[model samples]
Target: MSSPSSTLGGSKHAIKLTQGLVALFAFSCGAIVANLYYAQPITELISPSLHMSAGSAGLIVSLTQIGYALGLFFIVPLGDLLENRKLMITTALVSIASLAAASLAHSPGWFLAISLLIGFSSVAVQILIPLAAHLAPDHARGRIVGTIMSGLLLGILLSRPLSSLVADHFGWRFVFAAAAVLMALVTTVLALTIPRRQPEHQATYFELIGSLLHLVRTMPVLRHRALYQGLVFASFSLFWTAVPIELTRHYGLSQSAIALFALVGAIGATSAPVAGRLADAGHSVRATLVALSAATLAYTPALVHPAFGVYGLVVTGIVLDFAAQMNMVLGQREIYALHAASRGRLNALYMTSIFVGGALGSALASPLYERGGWTLVAGAALVFPLIACVHYWFVGRPHAHGRT
Candidate 1:
């Protein structure tokens, strides 16, 4: 492994990633990304506290996702044009402020605005992932990405339970306050350890943003991976958004019980590194199929027994999380291999589509649950991954084994 100080500001240095650095990158990604999900299991608590209507409560999650999508389009691409370490640290500071503000927000509108900021700043993780790719050798890039992504997926999976547990005991406001402190610690650690990389791209910010359209127009792999992941992510968002309501309303589970249920879902995060290894070993196409099929089929246990209790939903959560996360890592591995110089922009385009899908899913959750209940929500979720599977079957080719 190359020392961190050995490869500053020049692409000519051979960048060999160390395990300690990978762990730091993984931990930072996990801690930062956790900010987006802390509200998922506590929306019911937040709605009443802020006088938000039950119908519009989904906005808490959707607005955050919308902000994340906006940031992906406007901010993450700067990784190619700026000093990455400074940019990430600046973004982390903004996230800390947003999380702090969210805790103090008394009005629905105020809290919603803060939610958007939290999501916007959380795109630092996207920038960091590409940086990891830049540091890794070609042979180990997928595995390294997968290992770091495992931390990210763990953050996503664990945030729900952590927030639920916190909210149940100390109110939802405390959740954000605690998250602010955690973000501060993560930012300080990352600033101290993460190496600086000055991007060689010399374009102005406008040109960098403008080039996104051209990249989208030309990169079939980017479009295909984005489309597939977006559909599956929508399903992921829908199931998680509605399941909290289902558990609370029908099963009479308390916030802590819901927390426990969410913890079970964390088991699915183990698939991320496994998927990464598969992608590295020339099995991405088969893995993609497995991921899509697993996502579509994950809803079966719940659909077959809508009233069969939390165990069935637990099964659904684990399988869906496993499938969605696997597909995510697979997509990242492929896109990161596309154009080394354009990775930041490619990731920006790819992640923007995903959050758009997630925002739509979250926006639909309340209305779907209110009108048609779990059956309708589960049915809608099923259709998303199933559509991806159909599209992959007819349109996707087996050439994923080769580098694009």
Candidate 2:
């Protein structure tokens, strides 16, 4: 017979127990997120084996990003209508199945379909980000969000290099199969550790998604922050998509070496938690502007030193990911404050805008890099953030109202 005190003790233990689970939650999200990126670096390897062209190879990445954009808009809002834990698990299982299908794909069409499924299911990580914020104490929310974002950023950066090594050692098909197994193990851990909390919002799926337009119109803060996040992400997309291509084409470096160099800059992604800490301290809005502006400046140096672009490249990579992750942390912090009971809907708005920026980035990059090289691309990337700085320059300050 456990006394009330002992029952309280167990609950305390569970919250403390949540730290490791939170870290694993972050880790699992990162791993699942990596599924969409394997096609980017390995495009050369994938194209030849399937007898496709370079432009078509890039379409693989573009298609999945498009899928993610669609998911963030459609599937993610279901978190507001259903239990998050169940939604996460179901999506994870579907993601694993998709990976296996991709592994055995005989045509690019088959691979494309599986890639879309992978993107759709990978929103589990996005759901978990807001869920972590919801469960955490308001005081500690930033650090926790940061820690999880770090795991996610690492998974994104390391995905390319690790897949390269795996593809080099075995065939590319094995890469997909191996990822499927890891996602399955992740699904098990998540099912065991994550608590089931039904949504507080009662909106239908259609109602939830339709709210996006209304939110954009009525919510000044959401509109300002959403557009700010979009520009920041656009700058990020422009920088990353161009850097790897320039490194391989102009610098004449091996693919493996460039991948590792990318891994080096991944070191900067650890700033997520720090940004979160700042946000928790009531500095989220200011921090986002400063960090994104700094990243815009960092993009310039990378373009100038085409010869020693490695040094510039790694530095820019760090700033790009760090600032973007920080902005995400800050944006979500703002949204969480604004919508205490409707985080799923708030997140859908923010994420949908950010990913759309990415799709736009990948689309613009191939053309700019092909025609004018890094100078034009870098210049174009910097222009948006400057415009963001100008807009927010006037809106003047954060809103002091709440709807949650």
Candidate 3:
């Protein structure tokens, strides 16, 4: 049997989180995660400035996500073995350097390299999430995770418009330069305000990473949650990455106009907090299904009419983002409940899979768009969530009502 403190750790009555700390984690995560996306909307601006070809511009986005996936697998697992506060601060410092270097990069090779470093260090946000779960009682875990995720989703949604607007006025380089400055502020706040947390598990770095594979094999919950969120995230990546290109190419939108379009999608960030509440109330399975259906349906407008124009695409963005954010928070809530000692590793595997899917989506966006345009991209994007829905039906339904 677990110890009394361990037992209490799972109960809402034992420990409660402060609103200020929660807000700090949320804001820091938003600020840090925004680094990965600053390149997406401004790829058009960056490509020509560096004398790179349009065909290869998507690489900037994909490589950053790829680096994030790698960090999730390799670096995030350290959360289970190290002190959380120090780890986050260290990673943020590295991210600050990368962002600064990216701002000054004069060649495609330099920019791409810096992008990867920026993504790798941005896994600090993932470490912060599990740290929040560790501090929160089990009953409030979902709500806390949702609150932090709301910041993350806002970062993802707002990054586009923010980058676009900044790039329009001050050039794309200024976006990363400004991001580096904000990252420095976030790092300082984290170092000062966040409490230290040391995990109970004792293991070497290799042992921690090796244990991840074993967990994947043993825990069906990790597999299913990761798979479901992975597919939904792929759809999310496909839409956001492709739509920016479409906005410029098809609709002839200026950078500021595209920024406004991205701002409209920010409305979807509201789902994160709501999804958290639903999970806290033991409605994870129901919420997961609704999220999947929303994702699949989000693509229908674009598929139905290739000529549905920019408004239809914006509607699709809002709905897709809502579905993706909701499903992701629900997934994290489920996995975080698995093993208190293993929350960090569990999150590592879960997010690694999701970002792997995201990498695939971003990597494929340009080629698919160039080959067949928006209709093909919409049809291809629909397949991912559809696969997730089928998996949920066949394997995830009966087990959904209870934790696996």
User: Against the true structure, candidate 2 has what lDDT?
Assistant: 0.74
Worst 10 residues of 3 by lDDT: 1-10
Clash counts for all predictions: 0, 1, 0
Candidate closest to the true structure, highest lDDT: 1
Q: Which has the better lDDT: candidate 1, or candidate 2?
A: 1
RMSD of each: 2.6, 4.4, 2.4
lDDT of 1 by residue, 1-404 (tens): 12222224455245457899899999889998899999999998999888999766788999999999999999999998988899999999999999999999998889889999999999999989988888888788889999999899889889999999999999999999999999999999988877788877889999999999898888788888899999999999999989999999998999999999999998988998999899889899999999999999999977887676788899999999999999999999998888888888989999999999999998888899999999999999999999999988888755354445
Of candidate 2, the 10-residue stretch with the lowest lDDT total is 1-10
Comparison by lDDT, 2 against 3, better one: 3
lDDT: which is higher, 1 or 3? Answer: 1
lDDT of 2 by residue, 1-404 (tens): 01111121234235552688678867986898888777666776777777777677667777777788788888787877787778888888888998889888878777777777788877877777766766676667668877888888788878877887787678788889999999999889888977665665666778877887887777777777778778887777667667768877888766677678768867767778888788778776678677667766767675676665677677777777777777777777777677565667778888888878876776677788888988788888888777777776666244512232
Q: Estimate, for each residue in 337-367, the C-alpha lDDT of model 3 and write its tens digit.
A: 7777788899999999999999999988999
Off by over 4 Å in 3: 1-16
Model 2 stretches with alpha carbons more than 4 Å out: 1-17, 396-404
Ranking by lDDT: 1, 3, 2
TM-score of each candidate structure, all chains considered together: 0.96, 0.91, 0.96
